[model samples]
Target: RMSTISSAINLPTIYALSTPPGQRSAIALIRVTGTQSKYIYHKLTGKEKNPVPRKAMYRNLYMPGSNILLDSTIVLYFKAPHSFTGEDIIELHCHGGRAVTSAILNSIQALNDMENGIDIRYAGPGEFSRRSFQNDKFDLTELESINQLIDSETELQRRCALSSFNGENKVMFQNWRQTLIENMAPLTAIVDFGEEIEIEGMESILNNIKRDVLKLKKEVQSFIERIEKSSILQNGIRISLLGKPNAGKSSLINSLTNNDVSIVSSIPGTTRDSIDAPIDINGYKVIITDTAGLREQSDDIIENLGIERAIEKSKRSDICLFVLEADSSMKIDESLNKLLLSKELQDKKVILVVNKEDLIINKDELRTMIHNLNNEMKNQYPILPISCLNQCGISDLIDLLTKEFKELSDTSDGADPIIMSQRVKDILINDVIFGLNSFIDCLDSDIDIVLATENLNLAIEGIGKITGQVVGIEEVLDVVFANFCVGK
Candidate 1:
């Protein structure tokens, strides 16, 4: 299938707007690649000869067979065998106006209509990256790294993706494959022949293979654990706001997100459901959920349901913001007190947020109240005072959240390597774990040597899937490349 895809790259030239499609930017990038790139470059530029490879040339593009000027652009050409796709490539750096981009694209497509012109078509999503993979410019893992780097929303995501893109993960996987192949050699020899081959240290070889497999399994499991821990960086951290009615939870949500995503109202029980607003805090993605405030009892069915959802969301959140109105005379409500003491929220990072601080003149009373609550709760939860009306202390709140987020999402250590691709991680978790465990089981029991060899083969193939070392990888390639944007 790979060879088939590689051979199909010979004829039609593919082009697309490599940059985002919009007029917001000052410039746009158009990429063309395949066998007819040189011809297309010369024809569009009205030059008898193609420009020097890797050199930029200023040219006025024109519709094929017509003198209609398309745009004044900076063009570049890359000769085959050394280009991104291992084929002739052309780049048109044109104005970002929609009309200009559309006109140039239409003119490029017109090349297919010429009497002796080569085939030209728009590039599909990830087609450029796929071509790079097919041409040996990159492997599946590196291609995945490129996609992750493009989609990354946090610093950790970028660092991990860049590390993998630089071949750190590839080198690690290659070493594992080599180890598997080395161990499999002795086992394969015993399995191939029905009769026991007279070999020295047969028992010793089997024992040594078990030790190696055990060590490899431990390493793989450790990596899996690290992947699981760091996955929160990819998926935003969840935060739930819990407090009494009209305690300014909604206001805090709006201030945190800098958008009025939740309705703010003075009347009690205004929020009847959980409202989610995803925000980026210091490059850390966070999902802040504004839940219906907790009360001792609610007659309204909808309000009751909202309160229930608040509890459920709080239980699942990584952080819980327990808002309290600083000016209000009422103490913590019965339901809120019950929730604070509940085992479900005990393990979560609960911060006592004193809102409406702008209404208070003296800080001593508020401090006494916080001190009392801390003594009663015995949790010593971090307390932050903020006034959403004035946006006071919001930055400090954000900073605190960012600090906690760093600790929660930290995957850095000198020993463990990071795998950013979910595809690769899934392959490791589902396929590699199964093979390794099965092989170990076979070795531990009085199972057949042939069966143990087959299990080892399964493990090898699973690792091969990560770096594209196995066969029948067309489906894997499709999934990996699907994450990319058009012309990437």
Candidate 2:
């Protein structure tokens, strides 16, 4: 009989520069993990015996075969099944010079050339994190949160990612899964030994299980609602600029971002596509999109496509800035009025932004024009005057936007976990909810104990999939680690 090689021994040792690549850094961190980690450490440091685990030691690193000094570095050693990836690991804190990092990496590659029976190679993007997940160092939710934490740009985003990363939501989800499993006990008893043993109080037990399942379902539904409401915190607030051609939409966006993100020209229809400019408004991330000018009609095909895209973007945005020129002739025409009162904008907040306020010589006339426009529509939209050319009223515009976002933030509960992954959302809504609904439906007068129990198991499994508890981990690894940088 052929003997099989253990997977732990067969696995390749991986290495990568963990620190960000640059021309020069203060210090570069190169991490190595696997069966060959200790051997590589000994070769570099010229050590006869194993160094103390988890202890940092200053050592002179040399190439495997030659006397070439790679660098005098700080090396921290981690023993197997205790470190990240559950493997023997070594961290080389080397000088950040380009040549120093290069030499250290080359020396590690040379180790594979020797007859050690352990393969060593450069790690691919997210391989370290992937290995960590495989080693039970992190769950799916925690892995996704780690990525979010790395990519976080706002205070809210950082807080949300940190909450998940700290395993706050993980504990809650595990508790819910346990509750489902506990409740399944009654049904299993009935299904397995109902005939053999006359299980008394069976009706009462069934009633309690139904009540518990119902309560859990409601709690999950409410949690989903809060996550949906707070989604703006993760994905930034979207603001769309809408108006006729040459209404200073481009100039206003440029001023908001403090950079000329959109082309500003005297020519109409210069911006033939939507241009997004990310900005910070009162500590919250905001994406201000400068869209193609809206008109009643367009002859050019590209402009027509741009116009359609602009309308679609406005519908998706949290706020719409309806830019209007400050000129007396810049009245809201039939086409503009139709859009203002359209069903698409019924739920969206719109602010009538009168651009080129410097041209409005008569303040009274400008106020009168706004008052008449509001009255003509039979609905009063919040209006603000701005002069993009003179950089006037920009602060006031920002203040107004901040107020809008504040109202949005008030709808969600901060104590609840902020779910940033669409994968989790899909599992909860499509799978968990479906299972809960089916279980509840099965609890009618007839009360099919077997069906109800199966449905309840479905809900439990769905939650398991999220935490990577019950399902195969291979299917979701690709999506979960796709955004991760090389070397984690």
Compare the candidates by TM-score and give the number of the best one: 1
Q: Model 2 off-target regions past 4 Å? A: 1-11, 20-27, 48-60, 78-83, 95-102, 113-119, 134-136, 195-198, 232-236, 259-274, 290-313, 328-330, 361-369, 406-417, 471-479
Write down the lDDT of every candidate, Cα atoms only.
0.76, 0.77
C-alpha RMSD in Å of predicted model 1 compared with the true structure: 5.2
Please give the clash total of every predicted structure, in order: 0, 0
Candidate 1 lDDT, 22-111, residue by residue in tens: 666789999999888877887788888758988888899987777889889999888887898888889999989788898888888877
The lowest-lDDT stretch of 10 consecutive residues in candidate 2 is: 260-269
Task: List pairs with backbone clashes in candidate 1.
Answer: none
Task: Point to the candidate with the largest lDDT.
Answer: 2
Query: What tens digits encode model 2's per-residue C-alpha lDDT throughout 140-231?
Result: 78988888887776666777789889998789789889999999887888988855667899878878887888888888898787678777
In model 1, the worst 10-residue window by lDDT is: 260-269
